[model samples]
Target: MSSTRLLVIQPSRTNPPAALAEWLRDAGAELDVVLASEQPLPASLDGYAGVVCLGGEMSALDDLRHPWLASVRKLLAEAVTRNVPTLAICLGAQLLAAATGGVVRPMEDGPEVGGRLVAKRDSVGTDPLFADLPWTPDVLQFHSDEISSLPAGAQLLASSPRCQNQAFLVGTCAYGVQFHIETTTETVLEWAAADPEAAERAPRGGFTRDGLDQLHEDLAETWKPFAQRFVRLAEEGPRPNGSLGRNLPLV
Candidate 1:
Protein backbone atom coordinates (compact mmCIF):
# COMPACT_ATOMS: atom_id res chain seq x y z
CA MET A 1 0.00 0.00 0.00
CA SER A 2 1.78 3.09 1.30
CA SER A 3 4.92 1.70 2.90
CA THR A 4 8.53 0.95 1.98
CA ARG A 5 7.91 -2.77 2.06
CA LEU A 6 8.42 -4.90 -1.04
CA LEU A 7 6.33 -7.96 -1.85
CA VAL A 8 8.60 -10.93 -2.54
CA ILE A 9 6.47 -13.61 -4.15
CA GLN A 10 8.03 -17.04 -4.17
CA PRO A 11 6.06 -19.17 -6.59
CA SER A 12 8.00 -22.31 -5.71
CA ARG A 13 10.08 -23.57 -2.81
CA THR A 14 13.32 -24.08 -4.73
CA ASN A 15 13.60 -20.52 -6.06
CA PRO A 16 14.35 -18.72 -2.82
CA PRO A 17 17.37 -16.46 -2.89
CA ALA A 18 20.47 -17.73 -1.14
CA ALA A 19 22.13 -14.30 -1.14
CA LEU A 20 19.60 -11.80 -2.46
CA ALA A 21 17.69 -11.47 0.80
CA GLU A 22 20.68 -10.01 2.62
CA TRP A 23 21.60 -7.86 -0.35
CA LEU A 24 18.17 -6.22 -0.46
CA ARG A 25 18.03 -5.73 3.31
CA ASP A 26 21.46 -4.12 3.21
CA ALA A 27 20.21 -1.70 0.57
CA GLY A 28 17.59 -0.18 2.90
CA ALA A 29 14.48 -2.12 1.94
CA GLU A 30 12.19 -4.39 3.89
CA LEU A 31 10.61 -7.43 2.26
CA ASP A 32 7.19 -8.99 2.85
CA VAL A 33 7.54 -12.47 1.47
CA VAL A 34 4.59 -14.45 0.09
CA LEU A 35 4.92 -18.15 -0.55
CA ALA A 36 2.49 -18.07 -3.47
CA SER A 37 2.67 -21.81 -3.93
CA GLU A 38 0.75 -22.18 -0.66
CA GLN A 39 -1.22 -18.92 -0.40
CA PRO A 40 -3.32 -16.55 -2.40
CA LEU A 41 -2.13 -13.11 -3.47
CA PRO A 42 -3.19 -10.02 -1.56
CA ALA A 43 -6.35 -8.21 -2.53
CA SER A 44 -4.33 -5.40 -4.13
CA LEU A 45 -0.86 -3.90 -4.64
CA ASP A 46 -1.69 -1.02 -2.33
CA GLY A 47 0.55 -1.84 0.64
CA TYR A 48 3.88 -2.61 -1.03
CA ALA A 49 6.45 -0.37 -2.63
CA GLY A 50 7.25 -3.08 -5.16
CA VAL A 51 6.79 -6.70 -6.16
CA VAL A 52 9.37 -9.45 -6.79
CA CYS A 53 8.14 -12.72 -8.28
CA LEU A 54 10.49 -15.69 -8.25
CA GLY A 55 10.87 -18.64 -10.55
CA GLY A 56 8.86 -21.91 -10.37
CA GLU A 57 8.52 -25.44 -11.79
CA MET A 58 5.21 -24.89 -13.54
CA SER A 59 4.69 -23.16 -16.87
CA ALA A 60 3.22 -19.64 -16.92
CA LEU A 61 0.24 -21.01 -18.77
CA ASP A 62 -0.43 -23.93 -16.42
CA ASP A 63 -3.34 -22.47 -14.50
CA LEU A 64 -5.01 -25.89 -14.56
CA ARG A 65 -2.38 -27.41 -12.28
CA HIS A 66 -1.58 -24.27 -10.31
CA PRO A 67 -4.81 -22.34 -10.37
CA TRP A 68 -3.40 -19.45 -8.40
CA LEU A 69 -1.24 -18.59 -11.38
CA ALA A 70 -4.18 -16.69 -12.83
CA SER A 71 -4.39 -14.47 -9.77
CA VAL A 72 -0.63 -13.97 -9.86
CA ARG A 73 -0.83 -12.86 -13.46
CA LYS A 74 -3.64 -10.44 -12.60
CA LEU A 75 -1.54 -8.99 -9.80
CA LEU A 76 1.38 -8.58 -12.18
CA ALA A 77 -0.88 -6.79 -14.62
CA GLU A 78 -2.09 -4.56 -11.82
CA ALA A 79 1.53 -3.76 -10.99
CA VAL A 80 2.09 -2.51 -14.52
CA THR A 81 -1.15 -0.53 -14.60
CA ARG A 82 -0.37 1.17 -11.30
CA ASN A 83 3.30 1.76 -12.08
CA VAL A 84 4.43 -0.38 -9.18
CA PRO A 85 8.05 -1.45 -9.31
CA THR A 86 8.18 -5.17 -10.12
CA LEU A 87 10.85 -7.77 -10.81
CA ALA A 88 9.68 -11.04 -12.29
CA ILE A 89 12.22 -13.85 -12.70
CA CYS A 90 12.16 -16.97 -14.95
CA LEU A 91 8.64 -18.38 -14.80
CA GLY A 92 7.62 -15.06 -13.32
CA ALA A 93 9.09 -13.39 -16.37
CA GLN A 94 7.22 -15.71 -18.68
CA LEU A 95 4.01 -14.90 -16.87
CA LEU A 96 4.71 -11.20 -17.24
CA ALA A 97 5.32 -11.70 -20.94
CA ALA A 98 2.11 -13.63 -21.42
CA ALA A 99 0.16 -11.04 -19.43
CA THR A 100 1.49 -8.23 -21.59
CA GLY A 101 0.91 -9.68 -25.06
CA GLY A 102 4.17 -11.59 -25.44
CA VAL A 103 4.75 -15.25 -26.24
CA VAL A 104 6.30 -18.05 -24.16
CA ARG A 105 6.86 -21.49 -25.62
CA PRO A 106 9.44 -24.27 -25.49
CA MET A 107 12.79 -23.16 -26.76
CA GLU A 108 13.56 -24.46 -30.22
CA ASP A 109 17.15 -25.19 -29.23
CA GLY A 110 16.16 -26.96 -25.99
CA PRO A 111 16.54 -25.77 -22.43
CA GLU A 112 19.21 -23.23 -21.54
CA VAL A 113 20.42 -24.60 -18.24
CA GLY A 114 23.39 -23.86 -15.92
CA GLY A 115 25.82 -20.94 -16.05
CA ARG A 116 25.48 -18.70 -19.06
CA LEU A 117 26.32 -15.22 -20.36
CA VAL A 118 23.95 -12.56 -21.66
CA ALA A 119 25.07 -9.45 -23.47
CA LYS A 120 23.56 -6.11 -22.53
CA ARG A 121 21.80 -4.20 -25.23
CA ASP A 122 22.85 -0.68 -26.15
CA SER A 123 19.94 0.85 -24.23
CA VAL A 124 21.19 -0.70 -21.01
CA GLY A 125 23.82 2.00 -20.76
CA THR A 126 21.15 4.46 -19.64
CA ASP A 127 18.91 2.03 -17.84
CA PRO A 128 18.60 2.74 -14.13
CA LEU A 129 19.10 -0.84 -12.89
CA PHE A 130 21.16 -2.45 -15.66
CA ALA A 131 23.33 0.53 -16.66
CA ASP A 132 26.31 -0.54 -14.58
CA LEU A 133 26.36 -4.21 -15.53
CA PRO A 134 29.08 -5.75 -17.64
CA TRP A 135 28.60 -6.13 -21.36
CA THR A 136 28.12 -9.87 -20.93
CA PRO A 137 27.10 -10.76 -17.39
CA ASP A 138 27.07 -14.27 -15.98
CA VAL A 139 23.60 -15.63 -15.04
CA LEU A 140 22.10 -19.03 -14.30
CA GLN A 141 19.82 -20.54 -16.93
CA PHE A 142 17.20 -22.98 -15.61
CA HIS A 143 14.23 -22.90 -17.92
CA SER A 144 12.93 -24.86 -20.93
CA ASP A 145 10.37 -22.32 -22.07
CA GLU A 146 11.74 -19.03 -23.42
CA ILE A 147 10.16 -15.65 -23.99
CA SER A 148 9.99 -15.66 -27.75
CA SER A 149 8.63 -12.12 -27.92
CA LEU A 150 8.28 -9.14 -25.62
CA PRO A 151 5.29 -7.04 -24.64
CA ALA A 152 4.44 -4.01 -26.72
CA GLY A 153 6.90 -1.16 -26.10
CA ALA A 154 9.05 -3.34 -23.83
CA GLN A 155 12.69 -2.28 -23.81
CA LEU A 156 15.09 -5.12 -24.55
CA LEU A 157 17.83 -5.07 -21.93
CA ALA A 158 19.96 -8.23 -22.29
CA SER A 159 20.22 -11.19 -24.62
CA SER A 160 22.26 -14.33 -25.14
CA PRO A 161 22.94 -16.34 -28.27
CA ARG A 162 20.47 -18.95 -27.13
CA CYS A 163 17.67 -16.68 -25.93
CA GLN A 164 16.75 -13.54 -27.81
CA ASN A 165 14.72 -12.03 -25.00
CA GLN A 166 16.87 -12.65 -21.95
CA ALA A 167 15.76 -9.57 -20.00
CA PHE A 168 13.41 -6.72 -20.71
CA LEU A 169 11.65 -3.76 -19.11
CA VAL A 170 7.93 -3.65 -19.59
CA GLY A 171 6.11 -0.40 -18.86
CA THR A 172 8.25 1.82 -16.62
CA CYS A 173 9.27 -0.18 -13.60
CA ALA A 174 8.18 -3.76 -14.25
CA TYR A 175 11.21 -5.82 -15.30
CA GLY A 176 11.25 -9.44 -16.42
CA VAL A 177 14.31 -11.60 -16.71
CA GLN A 178 14.50 -14.98 -18.36
CA PHE A 179 17.71 -15.87 -16.52
CA HIS A 180 18.19 -16.56 -12.81
CA ILE A 181 20.20 -13.92 -10.97
CA GLU A 182 19.05 -14.95 -7.50
CA THR A 183 20.36 -18.48 -7.28
CA THR A 184 23.06 -20.34 -5.36
CA THR A 185 24.72 -23.75 -5.70
CA GLU A 186 22.27 -25.13 -3.18
CA THR A 187 19.39 -23.55 -5.07
CA VAL A 188 20.48 -25.25 -8.25
CA LEU A 189 20.74 -28.60 -6.48
CA GLU A 190 17.25 -28.20 -5.07
CA TRP A 191 15.86 -27.36 -8.48
CA ALA A 192 17.70 -30.27 -10.02
CA ALA A 193 16.25 -32.63 -7.44
CA ALA A 194 12.78 -31.36 -8.29
CA ASP A 195 13.33 -31.93 -12.00
CA PRO A 196 15.86 -34.67 -12.52
CA GLU A 197 15.11 -34.85 -16.21
CA ALA A 198 16.82 -31.51 -16.74
CA ALA A 199 20.13 -33.11 -15.85
CA GLU A 200 19.93 -35.45 -18.83
CA ARG A 201 18.94 -32.55 -21.09
CA ALA A 202 21.51 -30.03 -19.79
CA PRO A 203 24.18 -28.60 -22.00
CA ARG A 204 27.59 -30.27 -21.98
CA GLY A 205 29.23 -27.82 -19.58
CA GLY A 206 26.29 -27.54 -17.15
CA PHE A 207 24.97 -29.57 -14.15
CA THR A 208 28.26 -29.91 -12.25
CA ARG A 209 28.27 -28.86 -8.61
CA ASP A 210 31.76 -27.44 -8.74
CA GLY A 211 31.00 -25.57 -11.91
CA LEU A 212 27.79 -24.27 -10.41
CA ASP A 213 29.63 -22.95 -7.39
CA GLN A 214 32.13 -21.18 -9.57
CA LEU A 215 29.36 -19.69 -11.64
CA HIS A 216 27.57 -18.52 -8.49
CA GLU A 217 30.69 -16.71 -7.42
CA ASP A 218 30.63 -14.71 -10.62
CA LEU A 219 26.89 -14.09 -10.43
CA ALA A 220 27.14 -12.85 -6.86
CA GLU A 221 29.75 -10.30 -7.80
CA THR A 222 27.65 -9.01 -10.69
CA TRP A 223 23.96 -9.28 -9.75
CA LYS A 224 24.22 -8.23 -6.12
CA PRO A 225 24.77 -4.64 -7.20
CA PHE A 226 21.80 -4.87 -9.52
CA ALA A 227 19.67 -6.09 -6.66
CA GLN A 228 20.92 -3.23 -4.52
CA ARG A 229 19.93 -0.74 -7.18
CA PHE A 230 16.50 -2.28 -7.38
CA VAL A 231 16.15 -1.86 -3.64
CA ARG A 232 17.20 1.71 -3.99
CA LEU A 233 14.59 2.24 -6.67
CA ALA A 234 11.98 0.89 -4.32
CA GLU A 235 13.24 3.07 -1.49
CA GLU A 236 13.57 6.32 -3.46
CA GLY A 237 10.38 6.28 -5.48
CA PRO A 238 10.33 7.26 -9.20
CA ARG A 239 13.38 8.62 -10.97
CA PRO A 240 13.71 11.70 -13.19
CA ASN A 241 15.05 9.76 -16.17
CA GLY A 242 11.83 7.73 -16.52
CA SER A 243 13.11 4.49 -14.97
CA LEU A 244 10.11 4.74 -12.58
CA GLY A 245 6.97 6.82 -12.19
CA ARG A 246 3.28 6.10 -11.60
CA ASN A 247 2.25 8.75 -14.11
CA LEU A 248 4.51 7.58 -16.94
CA PRO A 249 2.42 5.49 -19.28
CA LEU A 250 3.90 2.57 -21.18
CA VAL A 251 4.82 3.59 -24.71
Candidate 2:
Protein backbone atom coordinates (compact mmCIF):
# COMPACT_ATOMS: atom_id res chain seq x y z
CA MET A 1 0.00 0.00 0.00
CA SER A 2 2.49 2.73 0.61
CA SER A 3 4.90 3.95 -2.09
CA THR A 4 8.67 3.88 -2.11
CA ARG A 5 9.99 5.85 0.88
CA LEU A 6 12.57 8.55 0.13
CA LEU A 7 15.00 9.52 2.87
CA VAL A 8 15.87 13.13 2.18
CA ILE A 9 19.06 14.21 3.92
CA GLN A 10 18.81 17.96 3.73
CA PRO A 11 20.98 20.40 5.65
CA SER A 12 18.43 23.10 6.40
CA ARG A 13 15.26 23.69 8.38
CA THR A 14 12.80 20.81 8.81
CA ASN A 15 10.39 22.76 6.68
CA PRO A 16 13.43 22.85 4.33
CA PRO A 17 15.29 25.64 2.60
CA ALA A 18 14.40 24.12 -0.80
CA ALA A 19 11.04 23.23 -2.39
CA LEU A 20 12.24 19.60 -2.24
CA ALA A 21 9.33 18.57 -0.01
CA GLU A 22 6.72 20.03 -2.31
CA TRP A 23 8.25 18.48 -5.42
CA LEU A 24 8.74 15.07 -3.79
CA ARG A 25 5.11 15.07 -2.69
CA ASP A 26 4.15 15.65 -6.30
CA ALA A 27 6.47 12.83 -7.44
CA GLY A 28 4.35 10.41 -5.38
CA ALA A 29 7.12 9.74 -2.87
CA GLU A 30 6.66 9.03 0.80
CA LEU A 31 9.27 11.38 2.22
CA ASP A 32 11.11 10.45 5.39
CA VAL A 33 12.81 13.78 5.75
CA VAL A 34 15.75 14.41 8.08
CA LEU A 35 17.45 17.76 8.23
CA ALA A 36 21.18 17.35 8.82
CA SER A 37 21.10 20.93 10.10
CA GLU A 38 18.92 19.66 12.91
CA GLN A 39 20.31 16.14 13.40
CA PRO A 40 23.37 14.25 12.17
CA LEU A 41 22.57 11.87 9.29
CA PRO A 42 21.80 8.41 10.54
CA ALA A 43 24.68 5.92 10.20
CA SER A 44 22.48 3.27 8.61
CA LEU A 45 21.24 4.73 5.32
CA ASP A 46 19.33 1.59 4.24
CA GLY A 47 15.57 0.92 4.34
CA TYR A 48 14.68 3.55 1.74
CA ALA A 49 14.45 2.92 -2.00
CA GLY A 50 15.85 6.39 -2.71
CA VAL A 51 17.67 9.30 -1.05
CA VAL A 52 17.73 12.99 -1.92
CA CYS A 53 20.36 15.40 -0.63
CA LEU A 54 19.26 19.01 -0.95
CA GLY A 55 21.51 22.04 -1.36
CA GLY A 56 22.84 24.38 1.32
CA GLU A 57 25.42 27.16 1.72
CA MET A 58 27.87 24.70 3.29
CA SER A 59 30.55 23.18 1.11
CA ALA A 60 31.00 19.43 1.19
CA LEU A 61 34.76 19.72 1.73
CA ASP A 62 34.45 22.12 4.68
CA ASP A 63 34.38 19.95 7.77
CA LEU A 64 35.82 22.67 9.97
CA ARG A 65 32.88 24.95 9.28
CA HIS A 66 30.17 22.28 9.26
CA PRO A 67 31.08 18.96 10.82
CA TRP A 68 27.73 17.48 9.96
CA LEU A 69 28.55 17.92 6.29
CA ALA A 70 31.41 15.43 6.61
CA SER A 71 29.09 12.94 8.27
CA VAL A 72 26.55 13.38 5.52
CA ARG A 73 29.19 12.76 2.90
CA LYS A 74 30.01 9.50 4.59
CA LEU A 75 26.35 8.64 4.62
CA LEU A 76 26.11 9.34 0.90
CA ALA A 77 29.17 7.20 0.21
CA GLU A 78 27.66 4.33 2.14
CA ALA A 79 24.37 4.71 0.32
CA VAL A 80 26.00 4.40 -3.08
CA THR A 81 28.09 1.44 -1.95
CA ARG A 82 24.88 -0.35 -1.06
CA ASN A 83 23.44 0.57 -4.47
CA VAL A 84 20.76 2.77 -2.97
CA PRO A 85 19.59 5.31 -5.55
CA THR A 86 20.11 9.02 -4.87
CA LEU A 87 19.59 12.45 -6.38
CA ALA A 88 22.10 15.02 -5.16
CA ILE A 89 21.44 18.70 -5.82
CA CYS A 90 23.94 21.63 -5.72
CA LEU A 91 26.11 21.08 -2.63
CA GLY A 92 24.74 17.58 -2.50
CA ALA A 93 26.01 16.96 -6.04
CA GLN A 94 29.43 18.28 -5.11
CA LEU A 95 29.39 15.97 -2.12
CA LEU A 96 28.66 12.99 -4.37
CA ALA A 97 31.56 13.96 -6.58
CA ALA A 98 33.95 14.51 -3.69
CA ALA A 99 32.92 11.25 -2.09
CA THR A 100 34.26 9.55 -5.19
CA GLY A 101 37.54 11.48 -5.60
CA GLY A 102 36.29 14.41 -7.62
CA VAL A 103 36.88 18.11 -6.83
CA VAL A 104 34.66 21.13 -6.37
CA ARG A 105 35.96 24.44 -7.68
CA PRO A 106 34.85 28.04 -7.38
CA MET A 107 33.41 29.40 -10.59
CA GLU A 108 35.80 31.54 -12.61
CA ASP A 109 32.80 33.32 -14.11
CA GLY A 110 30.74 33.44 -10.89
CA PRO A 111 27.25 32.28 -9.89
CA GLU A 112 24.80 31.02 -12.56
CA VAL A 113 21.15 31.79 -11.93
CA GLY A 114 17.67 31.83 -13.43
CA GLY A 115 16.42 29.44 -16.13
CA ARG A 116 18.87 27.84 -18.56
CA LEU A 117 18.74 25.22 -21.28
CA VAL A 118 20.58 21.93 -20.63
CA ALA A 119 21.68 20.08 -23.74
CA LYS A 120 21.79 16.34 -23.56
CA ARG A 121 25.35 15.25 -24.35
CA ASP A 122 26.52 11.67 -24.94
CA SER A 123 23.78 10.41 -22.61
CA VAL A 124 21.15 11.29 -25.21
CA GLY A 125 20.31 7.67 -25.97
CA THR A 126 21.56 5.72 -22.95
CA ASP A 127 20.39 7.59 -19.88
CA PRO A 128 16.82 6.93 -18.84
CA LEU A 129 16.46 10.29 -17.06
CA PHE A 130 16.96 12.67 -19.95
CA ALA A 131 16.14 10.17 -22.67
CA ASP A 132 12.42 10.93 -22.54
CA LEU A 133 12.69 14.63 -21.71
CA PRO A 134 13.35 17.26 -24.34
CA TRP A 135 16.71 17.28 -26.06
CA THR A 136 17.29 20.71 -24.52
CA PRO A 137 15.39 20.89 -21.25
CA ASP A 138 14.86 24.40 -19.91
CA VAL A 139 15.80 23.73 -16.31
CA LEU A 140 16.24 26.12 -13.37
CA GLN A 141 19.81 26.99 -12.43
CA PHE A 142 21.53 28.26 -9.26
CA HIS A 143 25.07 27.78 -7.94
CA SER A 144 28.40 29.56 -7.46
CA ASP A 145 30.74 26.58 -7.57
CA GLU A 146 30.98 23.73 -10.06
CA ILE A 147 32.34 20.24 -10.14
CA SER A 148 35.61 20.09 -12.06
CA SER A 149 35.55 16.34 -12.65
CA LEU A 150 33.27 13.40 -12.07
CA PRO A 151 33.69 10.59 -9.56
CA ALA A 152 35.55 7.52 -10.77
CA GLY A 153 33.66 5.67 -13.51
CA ALA A 154 30.92 8.27 -14.00
CA GLN A 155 29.28 9.43 -17.22
CA LEU A 156 28.48 13.01 -18.19
CA LEU A 157 24.89 13.45 -19.20
CA ALA A 158 24.03 17.12 -19.59
CA SER A 159 25.69 20.55 -19.31
CA SER A 160 25.18 24.30 -19.59
CA PRO A 161 27.43 27.14 -20.75
CA ARG A 162 28.42 28.14 -17.22
CA CYS A 163 28.95 24.57 -15.97
CA GLN A 164 30.26 21.80 -18.18
CA ASN A 165 29.72 19.04 -15.66
CA GLN A 166 26.06 19.80 -15.11
CA ALA A 167 24.79 16.25 -14.83
CA PHE A 168 26.40 12.86 -14.27
CA LEU A 169 25.57 9.19 -13.91
CA VAL A 170 27.59 7.62 -11.14
CA GLY A 171 28.31 3.89 -11.74
CA THR A 172 24.66 3.08 -12.49
CA CYS A 173 21.21 4.35 -11.59
CA ALA A 174 22.47 7.14 -9.24
CA TYR A 175 22.35 10.56 -10.87
CA GLY A 176 23.35 14.08 -9.86
CA VAL A 177 22.24 17.35 -11.35
CA GLN A 178 24.13 20.55 -10.60
CA PHE A 179 21.18 22.75 -11.52
CA HIS A 180 18.19 22.99 -9.19
CA ILE A 181 15.39 21.51 -11.31
CA GLU A 182 13.30 20.98 -8.21
CA THR A 183 13.41 24.59 -7.03
CA THR A 184 10.02 26.30 -6.80
CA THR A 185 9.85 30.10 -6.83
CA GLU A 186 9.06 30.02 -3.10
CA THR A 187 12.44 28.41 -2.51
CA VAL A 188 14.07 31.06 -4.65
CA LEU A 189 12.55 33.90 -2.63
CA GLU A 190 13.35 32.13 0.61
CA TRP A 191 17.00 31.87 -0.35
CA ALA A 192 17.12 35.50 -1.46
CA ALA A 193 15.43 36.64 1.75
CA ALA A 194 17.73 34.57 4.01
CA ASP A 195 20.90 35.12 2.02
CA PRO A 196 21.20 38.67 0.76
CA GLU A 197 24.18 37.74 -1.40
CA ALA A 198 22.01 35.44 -3.55
CA ALA A 199 19.84 38.40 -4.60
CA GLU A 200 22.88 40.33 -5.77
CA ARG A 201 24.62 37.42 -7.52
CA ALA A 202 21.66 36.00 -9.45
CA PRO A 203 22.04 35.81 -13.22
CA ARG A 204 21.37 38.93 -15.24
CA GLY A 205 17.62 39.78 -15.57
CA GLY A 206 16.66 37.41 -12.73
CA PHE A 207 14.00 38.35 -10.19
CA THR A 208 14.22 40.18 -6.90
CA ARG A 209 12.62 38.88 -3.65
CA ASP A 210 9.05 40.04 -4.24
CA GLY A 211 9.03 38.93 -7.87
CA LEU A 212 10.48 35.55 -6.95
CA ASP A 213 7.82 34.90 -4.31
CA GLN A 214 5.05 35.90 -6.68
CA LEU A 215 6.12 33.18 -9.15
CA HIS A 216 5.76 30.48 -6.49
CA GLU A 217 2.39 29.05 -7.56
CA ASP A 218 3.31 28.83 -11.22
CA LEU A 219 6.79 27.43 -10.60
CA ALA A 220 5.45 24.90 -8.08
CA GLU A 221 3.31 23.23 -10.74
CA THR A 222 6.07 23.29 -13.35
CA TRP A 223 8.87 21.87 -11.20
CA LYS A 224 7.01 18.81 -9.89
CA PRO A 225 6.91 16.98 -13.22
CA PHE A 226 10.62 17.46 -13.75
CA ALA A 227 11.30 16.18 -10.24
CA GLN A 228 9.24 13.08 -11.03
CA ARG A 229 11.42 12.48 -14.05
CA PHE A 230 14.36 12.28 -11.69
CA VAL A 231 12.48 9.79 -9.53
CA ARG A 232 12.19 7.42 -12.50
CA LEU A 233 15.91 7.72 -13.10
CA ALA A 234 16.70 6.69 -9.55
CA GLU A 235 14.23 3.84 -9.63
CA GLU A 236 16.27 2.40 -12.48
CA GLY A 237 18.92 1.19 -10.01
CA PRO A 238 19.68 -2.51 -10.24
CA ARG A 239 18.30 -4.82 -7.59
CA PRO A 240 20.24 -7.62 -5.94
CA ASN A 241 18.60 -10.08 -8.32
CA GLY A 242 19.18 -7.79 -11.30
CA SER A 243 15.62 -6.49 -11.45
CA LEU A 244 14.15 -3.19 -10.30
CA GLY A 245 11.32 -2.71 -7.81
CA ARG A 246 7.89 -1.67 -8.94
CA ASN A 247 7.43 1.90 -10.12
CA LEU A 248 5.34 4.27 -8.02
CA PRO A 249 2.69 6.43 -9.64
CA LEU A 250 4.28 9.77 -10.53
CA VAL A 251 1.10 11.56 -11.53
Best by TM-score: 1
Per-residue accuracy of model 2 over 1-251 as CA lDDT, tens digit each: 45667888877651252576666666667888788877756777667778888787776677887877777777667666666777888888888888766778888887777666678886557555567666676666667889998876778888877789988866555568887755656677766666566556665655665655544544555456656865655555533421222221110
Per-model CA lDDT versus the true structure: 0.82, 0.69
lDDT of 1 by residue, 1-251 (tens): 33368888889887885587777777777888888989777989887888898898889988889888877888887787677788899999998888777888998877788777899999876777989999999888889999998877788999988899999998778899998988878888877877777755655744778878888889889999999889877776643333333332211
Off by over 4 Å in 1: 1-3, 200-205, 238-251
Question: What TM-score quantifies how close candidate 2 is to the native fold?
Answer: 0.82
What is the model-wide C-alpha lDDT for candidate 2? 0.69
Error of 1 at 243 (Å): 11
